[model samples]
Target: MATTSDNQLRNPPLSDQARDRLRAAILEGELKPGDKINIERVAETFGISRTPIREALKALETEGLVQIQANRGAIVEPQVWQEIHHRYRMRSLLEGYAAELSCGKRDKKLIAALQDNWAQVKKAGQAKTVSQNSARSIAELNRSFHRMIWVGSGSMTLVRFLEALDLPQSFNDAFYKEQNARQVVCEHHGAIVDAFIEGDTAKASTLMERHVLDSVDLLASQADDHVSNLCC
Candidate 1:
């Protein structure tokens, strides 16, 4: 049997901690897209060794949050609007099917859970001002709300596929920051839940697909604005 030291060596706590910290930094926009990550600087900031930071970057790379270059350090991956649009299209398809399947199941527990989550979503939306923290809070609640539907679909394969197509938190952050975003989300989510209540699978699926696709326009606008800012 492997000893304690072996397990510790294989899974070092420092690496995991560094990875989490770095991930938060990236997702929170502290490390903007295209920002170069200097390993030495990060190591000093975290008061850890460079090895864990390197390992952390490797992990983030698999998550599509960063690209590591040979002989050079890593840089945050730029959010290409075209690629994001494609991802949303795929999400609409998979998540739409998930909603249909979930509705067909008529899982009362799932419905209740969605309702509860939606309440939290509305509460978060009631914030007086939109800030990064509030946006993050809403994004997390939004994720939980959708994830319940994914699980309710009763198909692990579908869940895995949906998870694979998931975008980084930064996109969600931007979406929630837009004007009338909270109102839009509340309306869509409330309608989706009502569709579920009436056991309307088609309506549920259609609403879910539209709900996802609708965000594409807002996000595209955000991307255009970002480009404009950079150009000017």
Candidate 2:
């Protein structure tokens, strides 16, 4: 149904940058979950036209970060607590399996790559707080870490399935911005990496499951703190 001109207009590399930027806005809470994104405003902000913005938003939609409408603009996907639980539940299963498979590969080069990305994740956690600007870099490192595991597993099928399970960082960004919470996350990353390095498949799987669930627990705790503050 589409014309060749329409296909030619799409720029994937540029659109990918836009997608990452928009996703960061959602993750940093600059664009709250369930909020509508203005295409024109985003175009102005990024100096790109609506076509690329649409492309990027559409891409993010596939990743569960935003939802697009025909009549309206894109909406940052709403994340209910139950939805969060479900997402993490799926992540625990798929990522745990990915980690388990990756550990079995026993590839030293791949292990080093994973370690390098994990170190970046650890370093990024040092910021006293996460902001719209800072979240992009951290997200990049986090993405790399997860992608390495998927690739290391050497299962294209597993990698494809795991692609959709990216954490809605918007939910946990504030929690991770806190010093104590950030430290705990860093420790978890370290332990997981250690498992991979030692080729401990079982430990990797268990740690991955715990790490995914821990995020949900942290978000719930943050929500409770907000409620208590209101009550007080």
Candidate 3:
């Protein structure tokens, strides 16, 4: 049984940290679909015990990233393209409705915050080279912009559902790193902000739905490439 080091004690619960690491590994494709997670090996690598590793795996199971089996360990879930397509479609509908609701109650403060967030996103996307850090930053900024609109909808249920349906950070990180994709996203965001400012609920809703659905093709293509590479 491994023991947590003194350094680990000062941070978040070992299980939470382990969960995050395992989640990242799955999303980043370090752990491909159907790959068995060796709990004991992970425990040794993290210098912790099997308990935390098991706890982490359980959390991921709920997130649909892994499937735990009887008398066996967790297996990474396959990234089914149809499932991914359906998720994006649902997001388009929910987020578009949220945008409509938000536009009905838009205020200067919400507009200002979105403007600030967009500014940061644009700045990060303009980097000469998209470093991993910059990509992560842009992804976070984009989420912040969308979340502001979601919260502005004043419906906690809608927000909760959207949160649950959100794709893993790794997907956004890769998407925003491409110059063309980043530019297109920024344009859509700017147009949506303008619609909100004008209090055009219909336009805002349409733009938001289109904005989200637009990425499905790119993401699907990337997913196919990823699966192909893993297969080879």
Candidate 4:
């Protein structure tokens, strides 16, 4: 898995790495809706060239994370409640199916690994390491947990399609930021583990669906409150 480095994230070019960071920031609400991203300023801040920044912005344009105006450069787009709902629907359908297939088939080794990741999430959250490393560790654990379940389903095509679905517009990342959200998500992981252990495919699928949808609702509600404060 070739990935952009954290150094790249901190000192980015207008490349995919920069695009990912900017997108993460927007989704995380560090850069809010209607905020303008000055390409020159961002370039200077990240110590990168404008070329990669422009390129990254273009990539984000396709993902609906940022909108580029003829004269306005890049601006964060306002995400409506409905669209967020729709995104979760897609996630639920895809990941739920994966969970269903995963039941009774998940490699024990993989489950243990996921368990380890959850422990890390707990440790990082307790340590109050809210910096990028802590955040990334948490996010990566979450991703690994889901991906392992999905991959265990043995549906390569489904896994590929779900991968294409990619990260939602910063929604889950936002949920991870909330103090209570961490505990909720970890407990949700526990629920998922229980279902898997029982070899109850239906239960696993239902839990996955509810877990994901609950997250959507939680994040959307928080986003509403945050946006309200910004408006004030």
Model 1, CA-based lDDT:
0.80
Candidate 3 structure quality by residue, lDDT tens digits, 1-232: 9999987767879898888777756554556777778887788878999999999989988877788998766777775344556788999999999999999996889988988887787777876579888888889999999999999999999999999888667667877777877888888898998998899999999999999998777665444334312111
Tell me the deviation in Å of residue 88 in model 3. 3.5
After best superposition, candidate 2 residue 23: deviation in angstroms?
9.9
Task: Tell me the tens digit of each residue's lDDT in model 4 across 48-164.
Answer: 898988898888878776778987777777663455477778889889999988886856776677668777777767644376555666777888888888888898988898787
List TM-score per model, in order. 0.69, 0.62, 0.75, 0.76
Each prediction's number of clashing residue pairs: 0, 0, 0, 2
* lDDT of predicted model 2: 0.73
Q: Cα RMSDs of all predictions?
A: 5.4, 6.8, 5.3, 4.7
lDDT of 1 by residue, 1-232 (tens): 8556877867668987787777656544456677778888888888989999999989888877788998767887776344457778999999999999999998898999989889888888876578998898899999998999999999999999999877566667767876577878988999999999999999999999999998776555454443211110
Ranking by TM-score: 4, 3, 1, 2
Clashing pairs in 1: none
Per residue, candidate 2 scores C-alpha lDDT tens digits across 82-164 of 55578779888888998999899888998888788778878877877777556666656666777888888888988887776
For model 3, the run of ten residues with the poorest summed lDDT: 223-232
Question: Model 2: which residue pairs collide?
Answer: none
Model 1 misplaced regions, further than 4 Å: 1-12, 78-86, 130-140, 164-181, 213-232
Off by over 4 Å in 3: 1-10, 79-84, 167-181, 215-232
Model 2, runs deviating above 4 Å: 1-79, 168-176, 223-232
